[model samples]
Target: MTCQRGWQLAVLMFFPLFLAACAQTPGKGGEVPSAPPPPTVDNAQSSGDEAACRLDDIQYAVGMPLGDPSSDALARQGGAEQVRVLRPGEAATMDHRPGRLNIHLDDNDVIEELRCG
Candidate 1:
């Protein structure tokens, strides 16, 4: 009988320790640990100042000869945040970058369109 009582007391004392060992420790500062946010797509073409991009500021690039150094100079002088010249039928991603002036040219290398994207 004494042996059984001793075993019961031993188990009773160790049970609380077992439960303590199984419990999770609190996070730093005693705050509950939260799940990390889900992954999101990263848009490489997005400009930080999209609202400030004004297409009308770079309209002078239209009708200019493409591949001409003078056109790039003009775009730089026209307050364009960024300049991208694309040739006709050229493969390009549709991603728009704000604060940028995209100059589209035809097969003849003539500037066909100028816009901010």
Candidate 2:
């Protein structure tokens, strides 16, 4: 019928426009959104002395259990402004900070490595 043919023709004409509207053009809605900036270290939590963190001083804590009462004391011994305790398979930021002490723990909750980040 003529009505059927007209409906088909209208669909054919508008389908491309619908698809074009969905298409993203660069600098319009097509541009990839920028990634958020990396987090900034909180100065209030830092000792403000970058040179205070000494990895060698806390090397002895490598084999110690994280839950031990002395663990906190040991971390402070390194004079780091911030202490980050990382467990096995834990995710941590890669940002480097001279005053940050990173304590890498094993699966058994034991300190595996002590380093300055």
Candidate 3:
């Protein structure tokens, strides 16, 4: 019984250290590098207002060729702050950035849905 209790105490003491070691940042000295700057699109347009990203403007794009859309195409079709094309099984964060458009595509590489986030 005493040996079992000592083993349990030892495990409790080392568990957090094990977790910390597992979570260490990769690269030199375990120091995490700063994140790179957000991507910049040359022709990305700014709608200025959250409501400015109207779904009706780009509704026609639903049946268009499926692929990553160019900033120019998005600007011409829908004047939004940002446009993201999501493919099937691809995970996207739930954060809703104003004036941002999310285009969801099916496995067949066809635009299936569009909405402003």
Task: Point to the candidate with the largest TM-score.
Answer: 2
Cα lDDT tens digits for candidate 3, 1-117? 999999999999999999998984867887687889999865344344454567887787786666455544764578677788888789899976667888778877778888888
RMSD of 2: 6.6
Of the candidates numbered 1 and 3, which has the greater TM-score value?
3
How many residue pairs clash in all the candidates, one count each? Answer: 1, 1, 0
Worst 10 residues of 1 by lDDT: 44-53
Q: What is the lDDT of residue 17 in candidate 2?
A: 100
Better of 1 and 2 by lDDT: 2
Q: Rank the candidates by lDDT, best first.
A: 2, 3, 1
lDDT of 2 by residue, 1-117 (tens): 999999999999999999999985666567865769999867764466476588777677678788772656765788777888888777899988887788888888888888887
In model 1, which runs have C-alpha deviations exceeding 4 angstroms? 1-47, 67-71
Residue-level lDDT of model 1, residues 1-117, one tens digit each, is: 999999999999999999999998889999888889999977654535454455565566577676554556645665566777788778877876665677788888888887766
| lDDT score for candidate 2 against the true structure | 0.78
Model 3 TM-score, 2 decimals: 0.51
